[model samples]
Target chain A: MANVTAVTREPSSEQELPHPYLLFLGDTVHPGFAKTAFGLKQWAPELCLGQFALPSAQIDLGLPNLRPAEARAKGARALVIGVANSGGFIAASWIPALVEALQDGLDIISGMHARLGDIAELRYTAERHGRQLIDIRTPPPRIPIATGLKRSGKRLLTVGTDCALGKKYAALSIARAFAERGVDADFRATGQTGIMIAGSGIPMDAVVSDFAAGAAELLSPDAAPDHWDVVEGQGSILHPAYAGVSLALLHGSQPDVFVVCHDPGRTHLLGDEQFALPPVEEIIDLTVRLGSRTNPAIRCGGIALNTSKLEAQEAEALCAAESRRLGLPVADPIRGGPAFDALIENCLAAPASS
Target chain B: MANVTAVTREPSSEQELPHPYLLFLGDTVHPGFAKTAFGLKQWAPELCLGQFALPSAQIDLGLPNLRPAEARAKGARALVIGVANSGGFIAASWIPALVEALQDGLDIISGMHARLGDIAELRYTAERHGRQLIDIRTPPPRIPIATGLKRSGKRLLTVGTDCALGKKYAALSIARAFAERGVDADFRATGQTGIMIAGSGIPMDAVVSDFAAGAAELLSPDAAPDHWDVVEGQGSILHPAYAGVSLALLHGSQPDVFVVCHDPGRTHLLGDEQFALPPVEEIIDLTVRLGSRTNPAIRCGGIALNTSKLEAQEAEALCAAESRRLGLPVADPIRGGPAFDALIENCLAAPASS
Candidate 1:
């Protein structure tokens, strides 16, 4: 899918945040974070998914089955999001959240209905770099990547492997790391399909999707203030039907600082046992090749490793080594935490041209 | 996606070699070979799209776009057939030719329109196989699979798979191979939905399918005949969907030979610097496990490997190694030709129950 809008969302401390922020919430918040992170690892490696234990003080912030605008207006910092006709619980609450999130700078993200019962009452949570959630009562609207890049703000993008993996988790982890380090960033899920680029300061908002038939309403150009378009792909790129949607997104709307969340584990080599994660050098080469192939002048930022299985030290070391190998700052800040935050911070740091 | 009746005509001794036959007789010729092969392959690699090569033939068999019965009557020794609401070529042909082909023994297979262009027909043009082309025309009728299997020379049930690397190709390939090797086999497609099995050898006159919606026309308690069924892995056996489908099929239809075609590429784990292929031992274990998981006493036969890039030799070696490791002769004779022929042969070769 294509990036929707290409406006600048520089991390100006004075810029107005979304009033009554629209957080596309789902059931099983942290687990959703975990799953999102796992999925994002396949796209961005240096980014991390941080799992901050919810503080005992937070209440169950659920706009159960509320419209996006309704949820936003009713003092919901997070709106549990779902698909339009998905015959599921989260679908009822989250579908509208997405619309409102886009319309009013709502800090909305997609959520699932399956695990709603687990942590129904969400409370205060913590990120690795000490950006603890005192209360989600006033979650700030994340600065769009375009704006950050205009002011040379670090920008990052976190992409999930497929449907389920902790994309939000990884984005949060990456975002919080940079935030604590005094970098401005935002974390968001572009949509529910594939290769969702968040924290790319660029306000280019569009989703070029192959499965647009399933999520067409969300991709309307008029849905959000950002530019939105749908596109297709050639062959199986990352996963089956992934390349088409990503190609559409990249070509349809050019977002500055594309931080791809990647998991080497998901990459299959024509079913050959001899083909696993190509060497780090090969990965860099492949990344450049992929970027070039996608667009000759396309500039790619650092890789974000999904440290789903790795501990903090191991993941950090792995990211650092990869960064050195690729001559890029591989910041996998959160080991065993949500990688989404780390992803946001990474996007904030990306050089605009590259 | 259901199999159409096929016209089985032996080449006359006086006929010249390299006989021109309809590679695909539109939607009427049995798609037996195409369906099973394609279905098996589809079930193999988790890759969504299926690729098939059209059968090799000097000229079209004049069976494109023919309706179900009309296409079956085409005077080809071995015809690839399928089902289409609007049949194409046979609007003017005599019914007698079709009946004669079916009665005298027509080598038929089933398939669908989507992959019709892919199944490469390898016609045995040489008379050395004691083949002949006859001009004896007859009326169109639903011919039985073979003589001895039926006490009254009729069939009760038939099974097939979905489009592209599924059970249709597997079933037809086996059927063709068996017939070539002196075993009587009748093939049928199960429409766009379920498996279609034709019971011809043992007893009964009509074909039977497990399809509950409209199977009463053929299914009868007294109907007795040689039976075969095709089942594709719906979901990963580990996946809940697969478990459910497997259980339902096994319990409902106690199939004779459970032919499974799968790709060994997708199941392997991904690691750094090198790729991994799931061990053949694991496949054996999984197949046996799946069989036991589905039903207690169901005899799980051999596993067929569907290779995309691997050459025939490599594929055979892989299958042989797996078979040896599993302590069973994994039938690898299909060798990249087609799926139906291999499947049909597999069914015919399955040892009779004690």
Candidate 2:
């Protein structure tokens, strides 16, 4: 609300503001404007700042030791943090309790404000955008769910065996698909990556930061109803200690649909069967474990034939067949190019029969 | 101490044992067992029937949530929770805090315990092993550290321009170097991946759950002093979140040195000539911002050549020269084959100075 300026860096007004609110949901850290600005400006000028949304976050280093009262004095807001690769996040264990407490109507804070309960009206906002659950809330010391409650757009989740399996690409493609479907989906990384808004149709040129400043404005209620979409990327598997931390951020605000991205070549392990990644079955199992079973989680569709591994016709046939088997529609989002765009539109147009 | 009996299918003998004591020390996740077993094994592993140590951990489903009373009721033993990727890990943050509180000053959950005014006793130990760290402490529900103590262990921040440029690989290699120097350096996903340790090491076959069990024993002080060195395989940097988190686990344990892994290929693109990774640099900046500047950090080494990218001879020469320049006792930790074994051994060796 305070002009949405960088807490540390000097704000650049003339240079289209980094779509601090455009969540770039993916596993791999997408390049930030500073990095993407290197070349390809002519064709993808939007990738520079105004036309794209980067996943990079700018962390507020000064807030680590601030008490809730002090943080409040400093205008600190409540947050809903998500870790993409839970098994691999540095502060992984702290997430669940933080999310749980917030879900149970407790105001979670750091060492300084551990006891400053109730002063901050914080909640983890979960919105169903497109077909996935998008966790667009900021990290603690600033949960932005209440303000942006009205703008809950699309929700997307990308799952892979690990970061190497190309979940990030799938997330971006899904975000693109949602945009083409006339839905506003913001890419959100739940783990270590910075924001990335490549391909097309984004808020700014891939704004990247260590914090969730990208979707900061949209996270509040005062923001316009731009019909947003969120692409939430996860770093790695969520382990037990603080098991449901990430999902808790989505507790009060669950997504509409949950799409699991699988690089068929990798997930199916070339159909070796035994090598299925993230063990598709296990992911579905874990969602229930984290208590998200109540939400309608359909396979929706998947990305199996990566251009790097399959032929065009083969890719088409693979997606089409998978959709047929699942009694749903699927597309390449990226490889199918514009035609793929049509497929996504059709899927979104279909009834929410599930 | 209790016997660490091996069981079939589910092993809970040690986990269920009363007065369970698990001793953890340093960041053993990298060049250690956790990284090796991760992604390969299910989150559940009956850590010693009653008390056991995990090489590394992240918030997960299998992690048992023990309240303060539950932890204290277990009694007379300690569990050394080592720093995983950075800042060291908290089994379940509050769980450890609760454990520390319940122990009534006779336990060491993590560096937090140290801050909480608990006595710093035997460094490490494991069940069945006659190590003193496991024998002399009471149980948990304690706040290892006081309400406001800064955590222990090294915190690694990554600095790099983009992925594929070798930042993640560089980070892993550096973590290994620090471990060799006896500095418990923990890693957290920072910027776009640069160099990673994804596809290297003993391969996935060596990652059976049984092996992890053995590893936990070996890392315990009760085991042979040289146990960790004899173990095979090392951690990988497959995902950014996991990589960073694991790195942080290592860092929090406070190793003797901080090594920055860089890729000569993108030395210039990395912004900081010193570390060669933007995230690494950002980490350094963040650390400084967090107000800890006395720690010694270094740009120890990196991967020199990829066959398609550079001549083999040049890559080898550059790697050798860099190792030589640093007076490093080992060669390229990332590229060398079995020779990497020596790298692992060297990484585990305590630093002479520290």
The model with the greatest TM-score is 2
The residue-by-residue lDDT of candidate 2 on B173-192, one tens digit each, is 54555566565443322211
Over 4 Å off, model 1? A1-256, A260-275, A305-322, A333-354, B1-354
Across A26-88, the per-residue lDDT of candidate 2 in tens digits comes to 222433322322222322233322111113443221113332233334332332121233332
TM-score of 1: 0.29
Candidate 1, residue A337: the lDDT equals 37
By summed lDDT, which 10 consecutive residues of candidate 1 chain A come out lowest?
A143-152
lDDT of 1 by residue, A1-354 (tens): 121211123223233222222223243344333333334333343222221112221223322334434554665443223222243334334333233334532343332323232222211111111111111111123321110001122223343333233334445555556556564334433433222223222111121111111121111112232211211111112322122233223322223344445454455333323323334343334333333321344444555565667766777777766666776655544453333344444445434555
Please give the range of 10 consecutive residues that has the lowest summed lDDT in model 2 chain B.
B192-201
Q: Could you tell me the lDDT of residue A67 within candidate 2? A: 25
TM-score of each: 0.29, 0.32
